[model samples]
Target chain A: MMAEQISIFIENKEGRLAEVTAILRDAQVNIRALSLADTTDFGVLRLIVNDNDKATAALKKEGFTVGKTQVLAVEVTDEPGGLNKVLDPLCEQDVNVEYMYAFANPQCKNAIMIFRFDDIDKAKEILAQKDIKVIDGKELSGL
Target chain B: MPIFDIDFETMPREGLEAIQLRRLQTTLERIYATVPFYKETYDKAGIKPTDIKSLDDLRRLPFTTKQDLRDNYPYAMFAVPMEQIVRIHASSGTTGKPTVVGYTKRDIATWAELMARSMSAAGATNGDIIHNAWGYGLFTGGLGAHYGAERLGASVIPVSGGNTKRQITIMQDFKPTILCGTPSYILHLAEVADEMGVDFKDLYFKSGIFGAEPWTEEMRQELEAKCNLKAVDIYGLSEVIGPGVSIECVEEQKGLHVFEDHFIVEVVDPDTLEPLPYGEPGELVFTSITKEAFPVIRYRTKDITSLNPTPCTCGRTHVRMNKPTGRTDDMLIIRGVNVFPSQIESVLMETREVAPHYQLEVDRIDNLDTLTVKVEIDETSFSDDIKGLQAMEAKLSHDIKEHLGVSARVALVEPKTIERSQGKAVRVIDNRKL
Candidate 1:
């Protein structure tokens, strides 16, 4: 199933992350998997959160430029070569992976890895054909 | 259907020269008789107005620089008395004392005719609805274009500058067929149109007359592609008679045709003051042959451009001038390499990731001169790819080196980071000497 990630554009300076996290704290939103893409002048902080609407509105209220992107949550084995399983068929099928990150849940046995592919629909079909479990947005957030 | 002032515009080369000589002599005599500054300068040079027998004799006159106007200040440069002078305009004086210029009732009527000819050449007509966005009052761009549009018999909307959102709405409702303003403000209007979800193409504009600042060909292509209209270059300054001094015909956008009937144009080597042959780039020097209140004698414009005496597709015989590269005052000498802000603007216009709004900062770091380009990143170009962002900066810096043979650091900031000026943008900041 499809999951959504929020991206916030922040200028490169002190206490920006602190201010962001404080806003999220006051809004009572929990972040799941997050990755920060940064350059010398600015950065984009991507996050999967429990309440997407709440987190987005809170961050935007403080005048931060925010964006939303679609991502996929897939199950990966905990041990050796765990990540390679997700990459193997997708590479053979020519499904490009733009970016990915992972998060662990207490109720789930295996780790849930988030994937952002060039073609998310093709990546979904490739994973489903291989019988890999893909978590729904509601299911992942509730966990 | 005929071009404006067909007889004069298409006059044979010999006849045009004869008229030019007659007008030039009359102007020289008037200035020598009335204006003390011209009388003193010409007297010191041991040349009288009658000595200018042919068109070539104009070379013997001295060059009048902008400092001369600034030195005279308010009314000392006027060739006519205050009773005849009806209007006065002054430069912004950003560097110090402002240079002032005056015009009489007859001069204003002549200015209207010249500007009307300039507008018609740029494809405006009596049937066209002209949206004049050039600032009015103290600045010549506004009233200069306004009087011309009225003279052209076109329905003119003197919206002036600013009030962009309302202007866009007026554009949709009033349905203007032509636009007149600076190139940068026109582009800014296009951007605002995009944000307002109003397509510029929907405005149904056929042509735009843009000038008062140097713009490159690449920028013209961008403005044309984005604004969906024929972009014509109109050249003028407050000191010369404002927005009607010269303009490019809509039929041939290649070069701007100077109104030789009223003014004489010469390209000269700025260093040696020797006039250069046509096709050689040099500082543009203009001599007002028909100005009554303020007659300029071989005034140096400090703008770098070449003259083309060849015939144009539109069939006018007046000499054409290539688009100016940059003003001498705006050129940045970086590490002994001359770089113009327009060159940097051309580079910025070439890429989609960067917006057209930018500022160049020159400084001395570690005893070596450095150039830094601060460009505003387009909102649509922002992405989560950190490597791609750095790569974009690298590509811009590399392009600057390739285009200008000078190294520079490119900084991409957030959208709207750079402040937009109501008038012309202050594009350069030199921190080295200061």
Candidate 2:
């Protein structure tokens, strides 16, 4: 079970982030979860959107350097150390998390955490054997 | 100031033209007799050596271009036999094969004499120590300046290029009066010296003869202020005769005086190839009248500058050529390295994931030339992963540097972002001039 994340290459200049948001707003695309990794010269804006194809076309039409990456969404108990419980098993299995972000599902009591693992298949298999629920792209896109 | 070779340097216009005509006739006869390329060229033009009666008739001959030299390759253009050739030098072609030049014993002597004249005109004397920093080897800038300094009886340090710190150390210890190199490199040395806490002004440098690349007057001001010396512009090319074809007399910084007795200088319309009168800027073309090994007739230098036919206050009656303002070709001299846009385009074409659409942005950052290549990334290879994109950029940059010998900052822009023209694509956005 994997989710597609759209990443845009953004130059580190004034009002650049605003420009990206404005483009998305004009295209009527909703960004679900977003994260930015930046260096001195430029930054990469990683985004999970409601519609991948539409968002990619709209952004590409507006001349943005965009790419797609695969990530995993897992449901965790909304309790103390919920992230720790899910991370401990992957860490024990020697799986590395490149990056991660969280969002609470309104319909469920559990919290949905998105993870970009070094090896998505291996991490999914390990988490599956440990009885942790992995949210697929179809379900995550709906949220 | 002592005028070097008073007879030729101070010769009247009529006397200079008389010597030029005689030398031009001999040079034409030798090239037409020895080099088959010149024979075919002259035959195609329906002209003979005897047809060049006066200096003005020299224009009837076809202009020799750098492409002609490259097409001939190694020694096809040399008028003298291998036994008579003593030295060989070349200009870095950057595109393909280098344009080669050869020198016989007399040709070497002529080069030394012209260089000596250039040195003396720039206020260098026998007691002065010459620090030659223009590169050596196949490039004529180094050895050309070296022999001239020696010919002038000046102590030569032959400090070719690079090793910035050591060059400064030698400069401080040797206390040289004459510094010979490109103006940009001399400024670079000044910065390095300042960083080392060595005051360049305290050095015994009295004057500098800088050339091998075109530099602005502002650069001369910077070099003189930083190094505490008079920065004189010296012009030359390997195809004509390296580093001493012409030089600016220190007494008058107006324009460089071409050694008319040895070289016939002309400024012509780059498009029509029609000769322009004095004081009108055009493509500079040179004809080597006295060279023995490679006597070129109407060699197109591709440099854009005018000739000052007026008399100079320095007493040198030789026709003065203005410092070359630009080039007729798309050649860019970045930090003394010759870089062509076509060369950069070839590098980009070979690399994967980069589109053919690209623009080269050249800027002068902190008194140094900086090249930035803005290339478009193909949509198929575009990825959201930061590390993968960075790896691609690094690979392209490394490949470009390997091919061009000069480092460039590779900037990946979105496809169709670079303005596409219906006509010829404007490849170079030179911000350096601004």
Candidate 3:
């Protein structure tokens, strides 16, 4: 589950995203989903890809600094307060989420929210105790 | 680790005086024949080449100033013909018109010989590989050390400054036994090495020759600790011969050796231009004895130091100069007291809290000039407490005032706020409009 998401450091400059994607494409690593948090000089490029190891290696070889991170792919219903349900239990346990981004699967009618927290094991445990649906790497990569 | 010249290093007064007289005669004849500037100046001074028969008579010549060089500009100062000129290097053009200096092929050869002496003095030899990180081009430092390494028959890697990652990559790949550049740049490379998780200690860099800007003994200790190498200070100006005029030998970092064979040095009061007694701090002056193209006669260097004629333990006979305390040109006059940025650097390094990155913002608050030092705190020391940070700022401010006898506003900033420099770090930002 943790092997699918990769947190890469992309210097915030013009055409940086396109450059990273091009590097991934040339290496034949298919991206499942991607999001970015940016500041003036640099940004965090969070990616979920089919071959996380290959994409990481390819980008790194191309001189991009990359790091691995485990994130929860929580299943949310396609309705109001869907993200709220997935987030409340973690918030109660004080498992603060640094950031999150979403992707919708058209065929399943379900939204997958990728969550990054300071403590991954604690977050996973809280979600498990609450019986909240935490999708595996196969499910997250497919969506 | 600045060592005096091998040949001149242990010579007695009589022997040294003999060498100076011979070099002086040759220098005078060369300047008279090829350099129009020296010819005109000599005629006006009513001093003939024959008149300079000894070291005592050499002092009768007039002093040269930076203003004289600026007045002449480009090639007017060249004693040799343009056909023989090989390269030129210049001082940083911050104050006004840059002070231009020229070199001939012979001059370059002499520079390499002297730099080779500096390297050999630091225990670098033919079996070593030398990595030069000083910036190239009009600046004499990078190429100065580069030529010296080449002259010593060492494998030279002309890694001319910046791109720290690439510098380390080359450091690891090349496995150089010797490193040469500014002390500040080496410390910066150490930081990069740390970030890359490369154990620089395990690498092959055995020694370094660091100079070009004024740094303190404390800094020398810090750099030596970080880079895990014997760091030596080299002293020279573009007007004289670049970085290898004199250097520190391995015995101690006490003072720089003056290449008295090629250049004559004197410490004079910046105001009166009178020679200071040995061990009294004053402005440093130089007269190039061996330079063919640009032989500066008693040029006022503006750097401050004391002369040590006492023989060093290093077994060389060349006179040593204490590390320059400050530059008369760069000295800051605040409320009738003088301050140098190196003094502040010493204070900052002593603090042990702030990263080396800092800038002094000097401005007039009402009628008085105010100094505000903004020091960048290391990222690892970051915390979310605003009040505690303010306390740190106050403590720094108080401590600096207590140590330096000047009050300043100190502020702790986030890491990387201060600009990272590839060459000389700009520590002072004076907005006094003067």
Candidate 4:
């Protein structure tokens, strides 16, 4: 299932990450998972927060450019071949994984991995056919 | 036409010309006798001060340029001795030198009086509190306006430039009636005020006398709506006695009325050097007639503008000049500080991280002029990490501000992102039409 994520454009400067985190903290929004993609000039910070509306409103009020995106949240086995199991089907189905990150789920027993795919619907269909556990936006953000 | 001759400012055109001719002759004689540069130039042209019997004959004199001022250097252009000079102001010159101008006691008095008259024309009264943000020191706008405001018996707050937040607080606290600064800086102030949740409509500002940089009617409307004041244009150059050379009346913000009593103004074709008739746009030239210390004769200002001889509705009979549209040179005035592209080039060339290729982009962002130096990333300096590139950008930006006294955002573009001409890459991309 698809989970919603937020991306923010931040200048490559000191304490920007800390500043962003401080805003989220003051807004009382909890960050569930995050990934940062950086280039020479700037960085795009992706965050899975408990409240997208609150986080976006707070960050935007502080003049941060915020954007919303859709990413898949997959629950893989906590074992060593956990990620390999999901990748094996995705690779066989000719799916492209643009980027991905993982975190231990406090809500469930298995580990949760977030993925950004070129063709998200194709990847979702492939995972659904394989009977892999895919967490929805509400459940993934809560974890 | 019932013309008011009660004041020196609104004298009839014929009467003004007669006074101008007498002053011009006097200035010519003084400069010829005092400054060797003028004496030599006048002698080289085989002309003498007495030869300029009429204003028409004054056109026969050779034009003085910024290069001429540079040739004289520190004080050779001073018509009076050092003992008589009271103040000196300078504008940016080529290759790091400055175009120096000195004012004697009388020259200073003249400047103050003219400035006061200019303020009066802008609807500023002695009761008004003027928040002067034009940077003081060598820049003539600050002190020139200060003395003028004082002369007019106005409460002058010499809050010279920068400290944006503090300026906002001062505005809210003092409730100044008049704002005197470059339009760009005033725009910046309004923006800062908005950020601080202080509205100008809630403040006591009634008029803004903006000068030192070219601004548009659009900017005028923007500032008026934002600051709740009438925005009027004031024109001046350091060589021509600073910020009191001309000003627009608040009642009729059509054109700036040139104070022809002090300076004999002229317009000439920049390319051909032929005098342009009134109502035709050309390079502005001035002969500072009443100036005692540094009286200039037909000084080419290189500012593109036209002259309007028609009388203004404000009852000032002085000929009005169109707001300066552009400069004939590559000089860029950022926040009333003049910056040339070559100056930026020297700063960028000093940095080993960036290649020699660069372009300067100037845009008015939120009413403040912003300079962006787009430097080509050299292959050797190209790094995979964002921190290093950002550091390089910071360094370049710092160096530019340190050297040029103007803030700039340094951007490292791709190797060949900047379009290159057949000969050299295009240097400046100015988006501010004003």
Candidate 5:
């Protein structure tokens, strides 16, 4: 499944995260999942919002350094082997994920996972060859 | 005394001019014989070494630019042989390749003497200890001041740059009466000194020489108040000798005095290259009369400043030049108009509501260029109302246009949203990829 991730370059300061949220809320966008990687001067705020296009447009209009990137969304069980099964194929293909986070889809019992890999197209090709079903942006937004 | 070793700082006008003419003749002959770049350029200009009989005749020669130095590469521009080069220093290459400059034994001695004169002009003496915090190695700022202090018979503490804790400890132990570094770093030092509860007033430092980046009088006042010391501006470039080309005297910090005896300075239109009258703002050009390894004539410095012929209150007969407002090379061309970040700083300082932390990002979308200024709001100006914030942004946008002659999109963020730099803060982020 394809996860639409919005990455933003944010100066490390108070209320910067809140400012992003406020802009998204004003544009009627909902953030489903989020993660943050920080450095001394700045941080990369990654988010999986319900409306990526609208969120991106609104943030850009307000002069925020926002970047849109495609990520992987895999559906796995909540058990121990669930993560290993999804990661084993990626590891075998020599695909390295920069970062990843998980969230359980409320509509289904399956866990919806997000990952940032070095080579997204290759990872997607390997998943397709393995008969892994991938969903679209519209399908994941409902969850 | 050898004319090169003559103390030009105290030389009379007629005597200095005569010395400059004689050195100019010798420099032309030497360069024409050795440096191919100079030889070709002088030949193209159709000027002979004998043509430079007076100070005015010096203009008939070709102007040397930083590009010429880069085009020559390595030591192509060095007039003297490799054996004579005692040292080399370079400018910070943030844009492209750094500009390289070399010094012979005599050139090094002249640099040390000028730096010593500059320090003495600023009231530093043999009895005073100096904490030279400017960076070392390739950077000329640290060693330029270091050699001067040593020549002045002062106890030199080469603290170099960074390591604020160690700098403060050494400052306390050494009791240095003079400091040298960029203005931004000095402010950072004062901040750390405050947080650490170090009483700066108790320190013996009486003055500081700041350069390597352009700063405003606002910054100078802020640094002075914070550090409890008088701040003086020192001007120079690796292209000409180093940090000792000119400095502020103790009696008045109005403008820096150029050591006109050893170095000749002239202001001319940056684009047309036409000589401008005194008191007009233009690019500063310099000719080194005493530099041996790398003697440059009519070197276009690209700094924008005006000249003051009036003698300084400090009693130095040398002519004074206004603090450079900005760089002609850094001027931004938006559509057809020219804009400078310092012009925007003037507008922001006048408003009294915006903090100095700001960045200008120029982007082109759909064949139209947009200037977006991200300014930080001071604590007193913070407002919760969306309407109030929008109104403030609109006001800033209008004011920027009125002052800088360019329409810009202004967005006021919370205090400290933009990054602060200890060195030179990148003011412009141009995204207009050609």
Candidate 6:
């Protein structure tokens, strides 16, 4: 139910984002879904990657401040109201979503969304009750 | 240019030493008969006022330190009665209690005379208007310059620090010939004046007597270039008598002439406390021979500088002290505010999320000193949430500012990022040369 996400701390300078991606590419790590949160001075590059440990090690080796975060990958209906359908039940159960990003899975008619929640275990239990498919780390990475 | 006091300013060496000896004898006698702290210190050293037969024999006395002042607290070191004490000034003790100094009426007059001499040495005349930007209240810089300018018969604008734009407006309106403040503040004012489309060169500022903190010769060059005035370095400490202890003559910017008639200056090796030869850098020590209220005997200033015993080209026979290179203490003077690493460490220790690993970096950006605090985040408190980490940085910065009364940018680095030392950690990285 829990998925491992790699987060890299980067100074808000030109080419920093590209540098991180280059490091990942050189390490042969696939970035499945990504989001960037930035402020005036610095940015946090969050990635749902195919190889979390390998990507983190390579980024850290390149002197990037990197950390591993536990998130959730859920398969939702590839429809207009799919995100809202998955969010409505979690909101009702008082499960807070910190941040989320999505990517379309080509093999299935569904979208895979990576979610960081305040309580990942509570989020998994609520999603199970709602019958929404919560994908494992291996399945998500393979997709 | 008219000299402030012809008799003392151009005094011969023998005559100056005779005056220093007489005053030193009287000062020792007064301190021994009045302050118990000095009496105890002198008695413990098995020395008395009668034992001082010559100026060189004065080295037998025990050296007083900042901790000694703190132990005395407010008024324990005053050699005169409270009725005779006229004014009091203090150092901003960031680590502990403020070191206080009281002034008798005669001591105040002496301070004014020394400041007058300082202003005259820097080419300020009675007709010149002075804009004093040093802070007032208990701090000695503002009022010290104010009274000295007034004593020199110069009209003074008591615009004590801050309000950069307004200071420029006053400068434009008042047309003051002299500016008195820290060197950094004067440079900052020049930048603000430039931003306002007012050229400092066009202003009436002829000379600037900058002090209250250690500054470099490079900063002096920048200040002179930016302000279009002769930038003079004035050195003093509240423990001595404020900003007129020594002043650089405009004729020669080599070193500051110490007013030997009032204060005796010595340079000693900081490690061994042994007196260093002239022209060799060491810790500066001052013994106030003429101060009546709170005279310190062989007080350790912790400032690292040497003395030039040769006569100055300006014709002042008194000894000249070179600009201080650094301090013997861990104190960091940031933007004219005193900051200690222990204070920052204590503030960081108050928070559980931060590790004890920290470093203080002091740098100059645009002529103003900026302090940046780099601390390691504890492994348990580490989070990928950017907002949470930013909040922690903000909270730590706020705490430091609140406790230390100085603004510092707080940087949260990864744990073990700061290099650990085997013995003592290198806590401060000061990029500002002095």
CAPRI tier of model 3: incorrect
Instruction: Compare the candidates by DockQ and give the number of the best one.
Output: 2
Evaluated on chain A only, model 6 obtains a TM-score of 0.95
Interface RMSD (Cα, Å) for model 5: 11.2
- Give all TM-scores, in the order shown: 0.60, 0.91, 0.58, 0.74, 0.67, 0.85
TM-score of chain A of each: 0.96, 0.94, 0.89, 0.96, 0.91, 0.95
Candidate 5 accuracy as TM-score: 0.67
Worst 10 residues of 3 chain A by lDDT: A3-12
lDDT of 1 at B231: 95
Q: List the residue pairs that clash in candidate 1.
A: none
* Candidate 4 wrong stretches, greater than 4 Å: A1-143, B1-6, B351-353, B379-389
lDDT of each: 0.84, 0.86, 0.77, 0.86, 0.79, 0.87
Candidate 6 stretches with Cα past 4 Å from truth are: A1-72, A89-96, A103-107, A117-130, A135-143, B74-76, B80-88, B92-97, B420-424
Task: Quote the lDDT for B64 in model 6.
Answer: 95
lDDT of 4 at B13: 82
- lDDT tens digits, residue span B70-134, model 1: 77888898999999999997654323245689999988998999888888898888999999988
Off by over 4 Å in 2: A76-102, A109-113, B81-87, B94-97, B420-424
Q: What is model 6's DockQ versus the real complex?
A: 0.26
Q: List model 2 lDDT by residue over B9-70, tens digit each.
A: 99999988999999899888988889999999889989999998888897799999988998
Candidate 4: RMSD to truth: 13.5
Better of 3 and 4 by TM-score: 4
True contacts kept of 2: 0.51
Clashes of 1: 0
Which wins on lDDT, candidate 5 or candidate 6? 6
Scored by lDDT, model 4 comes in at 0.86
What are the RMSDs of all candidates, in order? 17.2, 2.7, 18.4, 13.5, 12.4, 3.9
lDDT of 4 by residue, B1-434 (tens): 22112378878888988999998888888888989998999899999999998999988999999999999898999887899998989988754678999998988889999999888888887888999998998989999999999988899999999999999888889989999998888888888889889988899988899989888899899899999999999999999999989988888899998888898899999999999999999999998889999888899998999999886788888899998889899898988999888888877777766788899999988877888898876446654335566888899999988877889998876556578789778999999766
Q: Pairs clashing in candidate 5?
A: none
Listed for every candidate in order, the interface RMSD values in angstroms are 2.3, 2.2, 8.3, 9.9, 11.2, 3.2
